[model samples]
Target: MLLVFVLILIVVGLASGMLGSLVGIGGGMVIVPSLLYLGLFSISPLFSEVTPQVAVGTSLLVILVIGLSSTFAYLKQKTVDYKSGWMLFIGSGPGAIVGAWLNRFLSSEQFSLYFGIFIICIAILMMVRNYLKPVVIRKTFLYTAIGDNGDEVTYGYNVPVMLVISFSIGILAGLFGIGGGVLMVPVMILLFNFPTRIAVATSMLVIFLSAITGSITHMVLGNINWTYAGCLVVGAWFGAKIGAYLNNKLKAEYVLAIFRFVLLFVGIGLTIN
Candidate 1:
């Protein structure tokens, strides 16, 4: 029975990591919903009583593992932007802690509803930006970074703008049990003028910080289920490597389209579930 459950977790992790690395949404969105469903179905006696908080905490641990796993691939490709990644990380840690603390006040249903709404809003915004007239810009060349495929990646960003985004997204990440890559990736591409690939890679690094910090808070709150997390993490490690490799072959537009679709799907499912 234990082996069967572990095998099931591995399959779930593989699918989550593949989609996460491809679109920068992170594994939490996948893990949370799936785990909840598994709990309802009594897939395992351990999962039969799984609560939203436990699922969220366990998901964060899995994402932390996935982020670390995927980051190695991004690093080898030189796709991870260390400087900008650190900047975002600096702002994310505190926000994540605050979000974790805030989570205690909201009921599980409230959290699910709010997160569902947030996901839908993000999906709509991504699609609208694609079709809408150019949003007015206040831009400055922030810095330069080298990408994996020898692309010259320039950073055109407003420091204040990015800082705010980093902090806010961190809060959302913690509150929703997501790693915030879904929001961060798009913001980096649209607002900072980063290439889609660079944004995806950078988002991994940011997620690393957000997930770890949030996981720590969840741990303190006794929210994490180590048995589930351990199984998920092992599979996520291998899956992340595979996902990162596949990401290199995809086009930017396709990645964005898939990301939007995933968001919409997750949002509606959470709301109705």
Candidate 2:
């Protein structure tokens, strides 16, 4: 029974890591809900004691693994915009701290209800992601990168606006244990004119940094389950690598379309449960 529980967690970690890396959302969207479901169903004695805070804390730790693994792969591909990633982290890091502190206030029912609503909203937003127009701004902080076709693509952002947006996303990340990439990726593409692939890669960097701060707070709060975290890390490490490789091969639009449906189904399930 112990072995079976461990295997179940590993498989959950693999799926969460693969999806998190592919989308840059930090796998918390899958992890938190999965842990909750397991606990709610009493799948194992270990999981039966799971709470929202514990689930979020455990998920954040796994997200750190996902972020590190994916970021390393993106670095080798030279797709990561390090400057932008660092700048975004400036806001997200502090916000993550605040969010982690706030998570202690929520009950399990509140957490589930809020998370379900958030996921549904994100799914709706993703449906219209491609249709949105990029906001045109003067190139104040310009960046140039080679596109998939080997053409030079230039992008830029307003630092103040970017910082503010990142801070808001960071709070949500800490509060929900998401990496905030679901929102950040679209914000980069639509508001900053970032290439899709670049946004996804760079988002991982920011997620990695924010997860560090968020997880630390959770750790201090005694929310983490080390045994569960260790099992998830083992699977997430390999899963992130596989996801990063596939990100280069697959069309993100198609992948996200499928993912949106999954989120919708999961969201509705959570809401009704």
Tell me, by TM-score, which candidate is best: 2
**Clashes by residue pair, model 2:** none
Tell me the number of clashing residue pairs for each predicted model: 0, 0
Candidate 1: stretches off by over 4 Å: 1-4, 43-45, 132-141, 145-153, 252-259
The alpha-carbon lDDT assigned to residue 186 of candidate 1 equals 70
Q: Itemize residue pairs with steric clashes in candidate 1.
A: none
**RMSD each, Å:** 2.6, 1.5
State the lDDT of candidate 2 residue by residue for 109-174, as single tens digits.
Answer: 888889899999999999988788888866569988876567888888998898899999999999
| Candidates' C-alpha lDDT | 0.80, 0.88
Error of 2 at 55 (Å): 0.9
Model 2, C-alpha of 176: deviation from truth (Å)? 0.5
TM-score of each model, paired residue for residue: 0.89, 0.95
